[model samples]
Target: MKFLKILEKRKSIREYKSKKLSDSHFDLIDSLSNNLPNAVKNQGLEVNIFKDGSIISEKLDGIIGYHGIMIKAPHYLLIFGDENEVAYKMTGYLGEWLVLKLTKEDIGTCWIDVGANDRLIKEKLNLVSHKSVLGIIALGYPKSDARVSSIYAENDDKLISENRKGYPNTDIEYKDNIVSRRKPIEDIVFLSKWGNKITAEELDTRNYDEVFYYMRLAPSWTNRQPWKFILDGTKIILYIESSEQENNNYELIESGIAMLYFEVAMHGQGIPGYWNLEKLEDEKKYGAPDNYYYIGYYTF
Candidate 1:
């Protein structure tokens, strides 16, 4: 299967077989973990791989419903980042990339967040302070036909109508199932500025469709897809929409996941980009804030 297809087919697999990750697999994980692309070159993000059966078992203790499934895996990857601006966002992006890469290696992975304490895990790894544990990822061969959450498909006509109201002159392709839908290009791609819709004919022919295709497939909470991409020649800016409700950290996390998807899709296509802290003033005109966090920038 093609690389992008592997990404699309990947699911968060929880169950695992008894088989262990080979030396080569370990090497691949190590290389990818150690060599992850960072916004600041050679940043201090750290990843520790645990494979010893005893240590893995101990880590899984007291996590109800995940007792065996969590530790049964042959290996686990612990990702940590130093406390700083964009650290959590960067970790989220790179973490999701590792998950996708693991899928290509025919390994199953599930993201573990709840019930796992960074303090305890840090002591095990001898990691000092000034760094915070991000989360643990469980990886191994799957125990055939693992349970996966079902995706609901949106109605094409209805979605198109919604896009017509929100955007214009853009095209979108929908996969023939409840699992995939995309906003028309008009709804997203703007013409040199916000609210100025760009037509399909105005877009660059190289990789534009592919980038949008992969991004449209990215997972989001409640499928809100509150991300907007602005393309100016070699530069791409991401503008995030704030939630109407208060205390919406979950939405921010979901946006982080979307940012990861965009970065990976760009990398897989040989596009080089970097995350930045600078905010675009035009973004505020499009419903974003002047002082909101700038997720990243993509450069050709």
Candidate 2:
């Protein structure tokens, strides 16, 4: 799918009119949901467009969302997958992929973090025994005046903040309902080695500067964009801050969301590539710092 415009247009919508989706629109989303390619081949993510919103918001009240504050919409895009680090990655990728895709359909989405209590969540949702409820996407036609990520509104935007000028879209006038506060590429991208900042000219020369620019648009947990990219010879390796790498499934899902942005940006530019999730030697292979936890690599 063409992504730049959607990436520019994408942001979480917290408020929605309680009107449920029309049958035609529901059918379209159902088709799209079933056909998506799973990030993990062995365990494909299963998605459902739960038509009745109240069944969940009422049942899962205080069980989902950040801090038990649920963002109630008319419907939800529910994701179910195996309980594993790989599946968590798949959860993020599939969820964000659908979120971005749904943007083109004019449907707004928000990643409502499915909190702890997976057992209760599983029982309430009537999910299969094998797969766990990875996350939920509150979906609907967005209310005209309500567009902010309600769950993340309480967060201090100053944390890991960056000026908008650092991105490729220097047209600062095109601000969305929420001003983008993505981490600068200078702080995230390294040269052929760790701790070496990649110059803009070098990034531009390789046509990769735009990839990083758009990748930052991916929605992350609490707006903590804890993803980093390393230019290792022919390999472009992905890593997250070890400090925030693993804690339950939040960061793991964030890693998968980051993976989607990188892949989407690359493919959006007519470049063909995929993220290899196999472990890369961070310490022995490249002597990366303990702070950088290598997740995977993409050979462009």
Candidate 3:
């Protein structure tokens, strides 16, 4: 499917059919999950797939607001990151990648955080010492006419309009009712340094507009949209805001989810790029702190 169409059709599905997922569907998920990293370098992040709804229900009991209803789908993707071996940022990034891959396969997902009783889930999953249940994603086919929170839709629309107005045909692509939008290039995309806006003419690529268009629609936590992309010729450097203070891991995870969306869209459209981890020295020159977290890069 076209990347934009996937983004347009993708929505959080809490309600699902009781039918089992196809073997092909599970195979696709298994392949992606196997490739996903629990940590950047040799940190074994184990992703346990619970195909049985009964097991999911037994494990998810007492999770506030997340009854068996959400997990009643065909399966649950449990993402666990080893605290001693894996950085929280890596966990978030890789976990987000898995979710986006599922999205591309037409599977529905909603990321569940380890809240007050996260320990219960961790114990139920039999995670080893120094490992944590980073998040839970309920996966299955989305029911037609699934209802979404109006507030979520409204926030996403407002952010899209604010970020993606300058591109040609922006209005037609981002009508008021659409659920997502890209922040304008000026607002998010930077030059060699932060705070300096990279103009369309400055971008050497012919596909710059198309790339950013899909990026604006990438999802974020509470629509914080805390990702900054700096383009240097064939390279795109991803930087996450370092000072979320509380829920820093959660914020990084959210940014990772957005990055996966951007990368998938890029690859699906035949834009070749590879992700790397390199700190830009110019970040300090641009008034960004030295303490900023260097997530990774996507170089074409």
Each prediction's TM-score versus the true structure: 0.69, 0.86, 0.73
Clashing pairs in 3: 160-181, 163-183, 163-184, 181-216, 182-216
Best by lDDT: 2
Where is the poorest 10-residue window by lDDT in model 2?
Answer: 165-174
Using TM-score as the measure, the top candidate is 2
TM-score, predicted candidate 1 vs. hidden true structure:
0.69
Over 1-300, each residue of candidate 1 has an lDDT whose tens digit, in order, gives 555666576666555776888999999998987787655236577787888644654655444112223334567777676654465556556666777788888888766542335676566556686677765667888778554331111123434444222222223222345235556766766655666777666655556766666766665533566677777666677766666655343344445566766766777777877555455665444443443344655666
The candidate with the higher lDDT, 1 or 3, is 3
Model 2: clashing residue pairs? none
User: What digit string (tens of lDDT, one per residue) describes model 2 on residues 6-104?
Assistant: 877786777688777778888888887768774554565788888888888888876766445566789998888877888888888888878878888
Ranking by TM-score: 2, 3, 1
TM-score of 2: 0.86
Error of 2 at 288 (Å): 3.4
CA lDDT, every prediction? 0.60, 0.74, 0.60
> Deviation in angstroms for 239 in model 1?
2.5
- Per-residue error at 137 for model 1, in Å? 1.4
